[model samples]
Target: MKTFRLMSQIHLWLGAAFGVQVMLWLISGLAMVLIPIESIRGEHLRSDEPTPAIDWADRALPLAEIIDGQSLTVLSARTGMLADTPVWRLETPAGPVMVDAIAGQSLTPVSEALATQIALSRQIGLGEIVSVTSLDSPPREAGLSVPAWRIEFAAGETTPPTTFYINSRTGELRAVRTAAWRIYDIFWGIHIMDWSSRENFNSWWIKVTSIIAILFGLTGVYLTVHRLWMMARRRKAERLGGGGS
Candidate 1:
């Protein structure tokens, strides 16, 4: 009986203190699992164009000529397309630098016309071009670097807006954002209790709440088992008393 009373007190207090947060955790977890991550990221709206093949027949400019007067410390180099033009992309210590594959001319700070062409070519099911803004600083979305282009699509009543971020220097597609992504981000922020960054799962508040929730579950289990044992003993006692009487 004393043990049962102790368990009851613990269960009641813990539930009262952390019940709302526990409910939020369960609801947010269910939402994240139910919705496919790909849909949330708007991958369905991605361009279906096949990757352009590199032409080996075209004579590429000599590497020495491309880096003659530059003091760049190259990290890596690869071949890719920028607005349908083949180019050699080099990742240096400073940032990405582009050079025409055949002519070996430098191409940095991609022009607006080329950025628009690249964005439109990679996006599907988008309305007419709404706006293109160059960002020199990181936006709210995570994992994006500076010197990027934000291309936004018009929104309809039923269809929400879609935005694409492209690396202005390398012309690489960085990220895709849509209305669904924003919804997911909101719930994720609440779940992690890190509204500012939305990525810190190791916050002190979350750790404390999680510990309390665990204690609540343990006390509830103890109460359930104790109640069941007591009921069974009571039934046996009544049966024996009736027989002896």
Candidate 2:
């Protein structure tokens, strides 16, 4: 009886301490599962333009000539398009550099007009350019690296506000974030208890709350089993006393 009482007390106190966190975890987990990851990422909103075929017959400049004057150690090079123009994109020890394939001229530090055009080309729905900002540091989103252009778009009521991060030097579409993604991020932050970064799942607060929740569940189980055992004992005692009388 004393053990049962102690278990009940432990269960009650633990539940009181960690109930809100447990509820938050269950609700947030359900929400995350119900919502498709692609929807949260706003993939349906993007319209990827087909890559234009490179015309090799057009007397294109040699890769050596493009990098002749530049004092950059080339790590890798690939041919791709910057907006509508074909260029040789190079990864160097310093940073990414783009060279015009035909003119053999370097195209580093992409202009705002090009970035806006790139963002508009990738979007599908009705949206106007809200703002364009250059960022040297990563935003709240996870995949975006530094030295990029953040192009914001104000879409219709049904669609969420969208932001595209394009690599300034390589002109690569790095990441696309939307209002839905932000909503998911908020719940994720609450679920993980990493309010600041919204990424860390191994924080001390989460660990403590998890431990308390576990203890609460175990104590409740113990109390239930003890109560059943006590009830069985009482019934047996009554039956034996009646038989003796």
Best by lDDT: 2
lDDT tens digits, residue span 115-186, model 1: 788888887677777999988885878257668888888764444688888887877777889878888888
TM-score of each model, paired residue for residue? 0.83, 0.87
Off by over 4 Å in 2: 49-52, 156-158
lDDT (Cα atoms) of all candidates against the true structure: 0.80, 0.81
Model 2, 1-245: lDDT tens per residue?
68777888888889888988878889988878788998887788787654755675267777777767567888888888776778888888888898878877777788788888777777878478889998888576836665789888898567878888888877778788887788888889988999888979899998898799788889988888888988999999999999999
Model 1 misplacement above 4 A = 1-3, 33-35, 48-52, 56-59, 156-159
